[model samples]
Target: MTNPKSEPEMAGMETDQTITPVIMSGGAGTRLWPASQGDHPKQLLSLIGERTLIQDTALRLRGRATGFAFTDPLIVCNESQLVPIRTQLADIGQTAWFMTEPCPRNTAPCALMAALEIAGREPDALMLLAPADHYIRDEAAFHQAIGRAVPAARSGHIVTFGITPTAPETGYGYIEAAEPLDAHASRVAAFHEKPDFETARRYLASGNMFWNAGIFLCRPDVLIAEMQALREDIFKACQTTFAASPKTKDTRALDAALFAACPAQSIDYAVMEKTTKAAIVEADIGWSDIGSWRALRDLAAATDGNAVRGNVLALESKDNLIYTDGPLVAALGVDNLAIVVHEGQILVAAMDRVQDVKTIVEALKNKS
Candidate 1:
């Protein structure tokens, strides 16, 4: 992987680029079952720090970086989540432009709609598409990486920030970097799907592979043109929805009929993986998607190999995550497990199988 440029190396490379952060907050987060539900997802929960994930994301974009200026974040979320999200942002003293999806249509449509909206106002401005629920420990490093990506983005290349892999993590997709675009960026060679354990090890061993962080930077016009050329159906549908949506000073409520007619697909499958203008900037920002209970456990674990929160007793338990938001949870002689108690519901699963928690949620839905 290409090494991130040092602060001095990135000095004097400043530009007048205006970056609009588009925070995607429409995920269901079913893997975090009892604590995260349809109306209240992980982004709304204060899992990592005192601030909720969406609030943290917005706070990160509050000030300007070295090379660029930031406008208020544009949040893309569902109608049901609007009030809580607004309240959370208000609690943090941050304001945003909200785009409420009428229904779930995935990231491709979301990206298209964001691009259309931003392009309408300022076509030359850059849009940083970021997930509302990711954790980045080093905010300075993240901003530096964004600075590194700015040159390529202004040149009409769609830049994706790639996390330098620290281990053989099988949870995330991988991106292979080809030749160097400059001192700080590389041409994307290929995008690989999530691999098995053995393949993950191989990717870790390969120095050129990086974890896909799912964050993108590009000019709004560039993204709009690419979507129109590559995924015309999604582009047209989102355009129709955007045009029909009623706009207020701070919110855009999409038309339900127009939005529901759009197809569901991620930006990766719809455009990013297929775009020829893809570029990668290596970022060692201590990033984590926090996709499952095991991931949260790993992030919050203490010196005793246990991550405990609320009223919980973990006796003779090593490498276990015990959390309670409702009642006292007592555990004895359990290792490599996740035990969560929230809102009168309980979950006990082996850590290795925690990724399958979404399946249990699906089963519960079927039973109802």
Candidate 2:
């Protein structure tokens, strides 16, 4: 806790003016149960490489070879996860300013809190909002996308990075690129909700649609203005909460009472859909939201076409996902199933129905 110039994308931000990577780390993997819970969410879990997803996020945006000198990242996370998150960052020797949510109120308020806080110092400084739980295998391409988006951000247009859809993914939302903003960016024609498989195939065939990666870049002023104009209640509430919060080494504690009053909404619903200055950058960054076990398994390097982790044995099993913590998970004659063993809880899901695991989680909650 050495006193720096400022904190939370602040502190060392005294001189340098660069796009700050604001990592949102709160979503509990409802679909990825047992392993991803309220206490230990998806971002904190090491589902990918040696580092946890959040750690990997920090490292990737660590001003490495991105061709941009990004400031130390700022993270918006949950209150229940603070200690473990701090320990993880400490273990990795990465320092970041953290803003803890009083409760889960979605990305609109989170964006507001970050925008207003960072804008106080540098109104023109670009802020790039990224989800912590996502996986991007192509680091270079990601940096390239950010570089392209920075110009639009600097021009006062709120920009979102749209992933080039490799397949017709019905699970993710689509962004239709209306007009070419430039060779690298485009004017967002329409934001399409998750569509049926036929519609998704049409989107893929059109070549004008990109998967919404939920990554946003804009100046704090632009976002502040948009929120004030469109979602004023959320803006006001977050402003009050941000102003009341006491900044600490690892956490900025928002006013719990006030934050709870803020409207729970995503940025898309709050501002993006309505904004006239919305722009998008087509990014091919090998991206995956990892929203389900099936997604994680799909991204994993498979053996005999089955994704198996930990003490796993598979015989005649193909295209299935098996994960175990302390038990020897054996699968025979099973295909496209997700079998996860954690502690005393066992989750067995059909790969196609993995997204509905949230339903199971809610049912279990209701039972207790």
Candidate 3:
């Protein structure tokens, strides 16, 4: 509720810059269904490597880098996820602060609530807002990217990491980089919504566009001021909910009624698109949101063009992704498909249509 304690006081941070990593872990990940469910979302799963996605995210931001010291990660998620998230973090020998949402109000309200909490404690400290489910392979490059953005962020600019697009990705939004503010950072020219195939190709060919990585860095007070100016309704609702909530030494569960009253909007729509202080830092850190089965397949594909996990036998399959946790999957001459079996559910869809997997999840929900 109130400014509890600064990072130096709470976590014993010692550096010129103290960054509190806010790991946003609230998405249900319906697009990665069967394996990724509401109660146990993709962030809790070890989809990429040995550790869970959230665990990896926490570990990625841990320890001190060259120019900054990171406090323990602050995880934000639904109340139902608190126990599991705490357990997961503990498994990695990591301690974290948590804020539990009573209901989902998307990232805008989530960011505002986190900024309010952090600003109350440390107004000068920067908050690095990142999703728990992204897959970034290059930790060194990521750290470098953060270092490049810190000066701009400290100068009162809200910086978003822009991933160098390897392909024309229609699934993610694009950021048009305007003039170079520095060698590593750029002024944002415009924010474009997800484009069609032709438009995506154009974006790729332009050489001045990058995929919106959804990772952001800014001072908590700066973010609060921007939100207050742009979305006062959301700002007031989150402030009311945050103040009304009860807090422990490390956790706060938001008031359901108040949180539900807050409008649902992403940080992009609410603040970044309209803010004059917006900046973009180029990040070639092998970032992937792992948004769908196709994305996972692309990340893990073998030279033979198949991403096979568990007991899968593909005789002549090419460009097919098969994952199983229970039984063995045997595919014969299937191409460009995703075949996944987990728990008691199975999903078989063309890789081209993997983005439509949410529709199947909705259908199943209605059937239930």
Q: Each model's TM-score?
A: 0.95, 0.94, 0.95
Q: With candidate 2 superimposed using the best TM-score fit, by how many Å does residue 287's alpha carbon deviate from the native?
A: 0.4
Q: How well does model 1 score by local distance difference test? A: 0.89
**Superposed model 1: Cα runs more than 4 Å off:** 1-15
Sort by lDDT, best first: 3, 1, 2
Q: What overall lDDT goes with each candidate model?
A: 0.89, 0.85, 0.90
Give lDDT: candidate 3, residue 147. 87
Count of residue pairs whose backbone atoms collide, per candidate:
0, 2, 1
Give one digit per residue, the lDDT tens place, for model 2 in 332-362: 9989999999887999998899999999889
| lDDT pick, better of 1 and 2 | 1
Model 1, range 155-264, lDDT digits (tens) per residue?
A: 77899999999999999999999999888999999999999999999999999999999999987877888888888888888888888899998899999999999999
